[model samples]
Target: MNSESLVKPCSYDPSFKVDIRSHEPLWCCAMTSSDVLVEMSALLSQLESICRKENEPSSQVSQQTGGKRKRHYSNTFQNHGMVLIERMTNLLQKTMSPVPTLLEYLESNSCAILFPRAVLYVKNPTAKHTPIKRAPMDGYFSQATALNQLISLCHQLQHDVTTMTNHKYIAHQIALLYQSINQLGNPKVLLDHRTSIETTFKKIKAELEKEGEKAPCLNSELIFWLQNLTSSLVQSVKTLSAELTSQMRPAMKYILQSTT
Candidate 1:
């Protein structure tokens, strides 16, 4: 049987009812033996014809793939080729009878190693720059309420995340980071979280404010805890910064570009 993913006569068939599963790419060894030869021969044969006519031995005819020799392609020719490949890929994706989203494909088939891919095109997107979908709750006294919730959580946190993978510290730090990210959904929540963080620092200072001898081990432990929290906060801010640059900036650019 022809291997090269077999061009599955199943789903693609105009007669047969397409199995939705078949829309997902089946893993197969790259076009092997005769298949590669057949495709290459077809492509090269077409390429040779174009080269022969354009070169003409006696004189060089002007070629779309800019070069005196007619066979050699320049950077501009390669750029156009890339653009053509991208356009064709997009067109094929759209034209397919049944297509799976990238996320859908990712959900299945963990055994196979998949190449990382990213697509960034704005067809229709919300213009809102802020995270509106999951903003902190609103009420008569939301400001202090949210602030208190975060600070209380901070007070309760003693690197405690026993629920994840039977680990204590690693998962605990990640959970704290997650909470910080969730809090960032609202500008006020982010501000509140930061303010609560300062309260945490102040508490440490208040404890250390006692005069005379400070226990070395106790002071060291507090220092380590503070370092971890500070590092997590910095890392979170860095992530938000990059998100602003990559996602928000491009979105705004697209808005302006389309408008102009």
Candidate 2:
């Protein structure tokens, strides 16, 4: 499926109410391996786009003294680059089982990582390098990794929305999260997350309306509300991951026996 199709429109009605406490089993319908593969590919494509946009030069200006031109990115772009770097580093650190060789390679070739920081003046020699050429060991691992990244992004979005005091970026983050969840190929989980996010968006809208300010900064109440929403999202994703692992154990065991 096209990755763009996974992103839901951010429009919502303030009157909408979402019931997040559904009794559906977390493992109601697990995605098949092929479905997982497609979703993972879509997610990787989205991540690659983000990395590309992050490093794209914002503007270029001629030098005052010389004819040379210098490339510079806006503060917003730089801040995003830093955040991407931080997310990647966090993912590496939080890996449940780390390979020493892989860690060494990533550290030694920082510029070649999946999401390298934006370099203003210097050109990256490994700009064309693609790190994740092939799929990971299994679809389960890929889905788990994507879910972890989604959870991390949710936390970052919460921090950014609260500290930045602006809800403008929240829509984009929600869209990305929706895309990630959609790629998981679990319709029920995706619907749950989408409902929760839309509910939160409406709450934010109501809060803004209460202050009679268009584009108003998020207040303390909204901040706490967002915190709870993000916590719920993280917990839901974790539960899904655990359920996925549980469902795949039999297949994993069969593969191991066959290989042995």
Name the top lDDT candidate.
2
Every model's TM-score: 0.22, 0.37
Q: Give the alpha carbon lDDT tens digit for every residue of 1-260 in model 1.
A: 85687465545656766544432336644543234223322232232223223223325555654654333334553343344334323333432257544334223322011111111011111121221222111121233344345444544443332222222243344346446446435453246445555456554545545566343122545546655665455444445354323323433343344335
Cα distance off (Å), candidate 1, residue 129 = 29
The Cα error of candidate 1 at residue 147, in Å, is 19
Top TM-score prediction, candidate number: 2
lDDT of 2: 0.52
lDDT of 2 at 112: 25
Candidate 2, 48-114: lDDT as tens digits: 4444554443355556836554444356744544444343433343333552333343444342222
Q: What lDDT does candidate 2 reach at residue 25? A: 29
